[model samples]
Target: MTSKKSPVGGHIPVAGGMATKGLKYAAEIGAEAVQVFVSNPRGWAQAAGKPAEDAAMRESGVPTFVHAPYLVNFGSPTPETLERSVASVRHSLQRGAAIGALGVVVHTGSAVTQPFDDAMRQVREHVLPLLDELPNDAPDILLEPMAGQGAMLCATVDQLGPFFEHLENHPKLGVCLDTCHAFCAGHDLAAPDGVQKTLDLLVETVGPGRLKLVHANDSKDPCGSFKDRHENIGAGQIGEKPFAELFRHPEVAGVPFIIETPGRSADPHRKDVETLKRLRDNA
Candidate 1:
């Protein structure tokens, strides 16, 4: 296994504070990367990012990414919801640029009885062109695949190929593979061989260049369960061995592993990050 030199990266629920304090906290935690919500996750109200604060974060040399609001669903059957999702994505990209973030993460959504093909088409027709207009500095749109439980299009790594085909493989499009979702969608990431095989298939389908981010979460549910429950590192069904395999994978060698696991108190975040760092170092 290939051992890593710099295993320290990002962690989640960045905590409520002044924008600069968020950066300070990440630095204090020894994180070289960070993720933040540009707006309230549960709301449609978009918060404006301060230019000075954004510049401060950018100058910190930490690779940053924005997690889009949870309520914005591009695949919503309703026209209002669809419009909002596109607008939300556009706003997110703008916000990301303000903070010099590399990308913005948005969930691959369900079509709610509407054909997924049609929803993908909406993404292409209504969303892709806006991306086309943006400059190179515009943060890439990182689509996160959900567990295969509903009308979601990119349910698993295997199912995500059609999205590239549908989008004609837009340059700005990339992926954020969530380990918990991948496990729930039937990829056995807990096993060393299974993690390698799953990542190999992912690289084959999306190409390593487009695999930009990872939500390094462990799942509470069994593989192929299609449930979205997450657990702390080494405390879930996934254990620690597969994460060693994951951190060792050349495809994700320098990628940021953001923790979306449960953060009841400081200890869980501390434990999860420490466990991941150890796994990466011992890989």
Candidate 2:
């Protein structure tokens, strides 16, 4: 197995291509890790992965992760949506395994108009079965809590425990804490010692080992705004202070951070990576 190096990186766009060129783009931007989509993030179609490309990725030594489709919402009221969500997760895991990815990230979707209890039950009934079916060699399934927008299932970090309880706390399950989402969901990551307090809560709730990934984004909206917009590092409501605190936190030392900030091209991403590295070194 390729060992993890530095934990800081960003989500490289698949503008060049998937797998092959994606890996090259990540390296060019100084990413020590990367997150990519195995298929259309907005669609349900499953694309066949290339074995040669997968092998190259494994040998490239960059820690990789696959983000499942955006349309996947196990808490959806529609039966078709729930069914497709499960299938998309399954396919994403398979692709992750093929590419030797460390983990597969999926949003802990919204409950919509459904009663919250009913939504949890839907996750238990529909989502747990899929989790049980994951291959032993498959990458860990990392659940990313969403912004508390319209009945979001795992809006707050505390809610992660209940979600895990529904999944029976499967060994392969993990958490991907998105800083921007957490702040928007009212985690108060901007306060004094805020990042440490947030990490403490995560460690207490999910155990330190399961805190596998961090989405290092700054929020476009203010705290508790329920907006999911992301801005470049140090450029949003979440300034550089919180990020420096995040890097200094002992629990997050080796955890991979993938920035989901916005930019027209690679230049912005490169700068973000450099900024994060500087923070870590200085911290």
Best by TM-score: 2
Error of 1 at 59 (Å): 1.0
Report every candidate's CA lDDT.
0.79, 0.85
User: Considering every candidate listed, which one attains the maximal lDDT?
Assistant: 2
What are the models' TM-scores?
0.93, 0.95
Give the clashing residue pairs of candidate 2, or none. Answer: none
* lDDT score, candidate 2: 0.85
